[model samples]
Target: MSRIRATLVATAAAAAALLAPLAAAPAASAHGWITSPESRQGFCAEGATSFDCGEIKYEPQSVEAPKGSTKCSGGSSYTILDDNSKPWPRTTTGTTVTFQWKLTAAHSTASWEYFLDGVLYRTFDGGNKQPPSNVSQTIEGLPTGDHTMLVRWNIADTANAFYSCVDLHVVAGGTDPGDGGTTTPPVTTSPTDPTTPTSPGTCSAAAWSSSSVYLGGDQASYNGQIYRANWWTQGDTPSNTAWGPWTLVGSC
Candidate 1:
């Protein structure tokens, strides 16, 4: 009887070890940071005439923008733009993102209005007809995914120029800043905990973002859990042309 009991105990220990959960793997590191900057034609205008341009700046220290807003040293005719509005090809959503930009000169008024996907977000002045240089984020928040962030200095005038973002990665996780203990909604698989309170009116874990479409896949590395490849996946289509890796999900 004692011998039999020992065998049973050993079997249980082996099974327990096999079923134990593993720690999460690190997320794939983001690669290919901007290595080279594109050439800028580089225009300059300072303390000129109103409706023409006095002092101006390229908002949001960035390398992708070609034309930027101009600030004036005197008077306000800073309105009217048929060719003044433009946007970056990127997407937005989530909480917020910071932008890098440089200025050539300062507008006399030093203020700017921003538009996110055609919706007005906020506006601020550039202040002083100062020389153009570099500036950080002037505005924040614009829905997630792809979006157009337009900063027009003289909305009514085009001579002032504009700064458009080509691609803005708003990133995910648009949780409220004031709230604590908030969790992101799960997608495909049920969340580990259903009772866990989610942000009010947040989509369930099964719901995917507008940019994230379900497709076939071969493999996935989520939180260190390696889901192998199969045919006809539901998470995402394989990046490659051949199809074999399947992304399993709750299709129903």
Candidate 2:
């Protein structure tokens, strides 16, 4: 009887251990962030685009706050995002720009809003449904010049919202300030001749994982090349197909 009881107890312990991860999965409020055009949190999370970022440099997707709040940091511990005086990298773009968000854990959303200089710019209604692994929307009518863009994702079922900020430099269409009238002689080379290969920039900060769902602007290294996802994808190798989800960015 003692031996049988010990065996049963061992089996129960094993089962509990296997179920622990599922029970401890991250809550819906714990995930999400803007990646494309590189939000303040996104830039710090990758350890790129140097700036004095606080704790956001560690976990960009973790910012959370109640709805109707306009603070850039979303009341997160990483309050450095609220500092606009610090020079942030600007993304050169047009009036109509597509913004992307990555969601590690999907939640029912009330709406997504964009702000410019403390004014509401655009809104995307989510209809209280779970959002996709990746979310993107094109915003138009932005005037040319430097502008601060803030994106907010309001949770429908909860009072909290996620926030991200990006600096943009919009330019007028068809205005090309070419090479200042300077020209260089073209160098000729044989098509069949072998040449020394060069490095492909830098490898991704993280390894690619099949179990992980990547969103736009997320970088991963696979098979010696670093890639940025154009949208949401999983288990896709970088630079393997013309229309593949991954965009080759560098070499690992």
Candidate 3:
């Protein structure tokens, strides 16, 4: 098993040498984070059947975080920045990660970049940013015992290079690579009562409101989950009072 793992690591290093970067730890609120004027992710998405950004692509992209929607469905594509963005699980040495990425349109040339301690390490930027390049880079030089591998995206050209797809595979110490293998643990879900009820009794069509509800960015509780659409209260008929001002459920 160790031998297999060793071989896998070597192969991954080689492939990553050929390819190129990109998690999150969620808490009650967004706090203490590494912010950068320049921030990005190398998404490792293999392809689109599902909306998965495998990892952050070093290439430029338009993949922004969602505004207000269930799942990572719709919103402007976000540029990578650690400025109190969604928290990600810690990264460390001997961790083998793998994923895919895509760009809106490739320029002539691009580069590979590595960040150490929340700073830019090396950039493989060439003459232009046009190539639909596949990249992979390993984080060498670990300081003693443990550290977090915070990776983001950087474009040869922000104007020309726009990202489309990505995904990631990273595990501390060692493990087979795939999209941050540790995601929300497998759940055997059953319907539970709402901690706070919108209606006095049961939620009903009659309880629905149509007041123009403004879904604010600050009200976003889940990293990429939308509360507006889900558990929305509609009006009896399209009246001015019922016309709308719908607030997201459970989020004042």
Question: Which one is best on lDDT?
Answer: 2
User: Over 4 Å off in model 2, which ranges?
Assistant: 1-28, 174-252
How far in Å is the alpha carbon of 205 misplaced in model 3? Answer: 31
Kindly indicate the candidate among 1 and 3 with the higher lDDT: 1
Residue 192 deviation, candidate 1, in Å? 42
Q: How close is candidate 1 to the true structure, as a TM-score?
A: 0.30
Tell me the tens digit of each residue's lDDT in model 3 across 20-100.
Answer: 531132211110111111122321111212233333322123343322221121132332223223443332324444222
Report the C-alpha lDDT of model 1 over 151-225, residue by residue, as the tens digit.
Answer: 444322223334432234455685322112222222223342322323343222333322443221223434322
Tens digits of per-residue lDDT for model 2, 1-252 = 999999999999999999999899646455777766677787776656566576666567778987776778877666788888887877787777777776767889999999987789999899999977667777778889998888999998887898888888889772211111122111112122112223665663588888897755577787777666655566766664544667565555
Of the two candidates 1 and 2, the one with more favorable TM-score, higher being better, is 2
Question: Each model's TM-score, in the order given?
Answer: 0.30, 0.61, 0.30
Give the candidates in order of lDDT, highest first.
2, 1, 3
Stretches of candidate 1 off by over 4 Å are 1-94, 154-161, 174-252
Model 3 quality (TM-score): 0.30
Lowest lDDT block of 10, candidate 2: 185-194
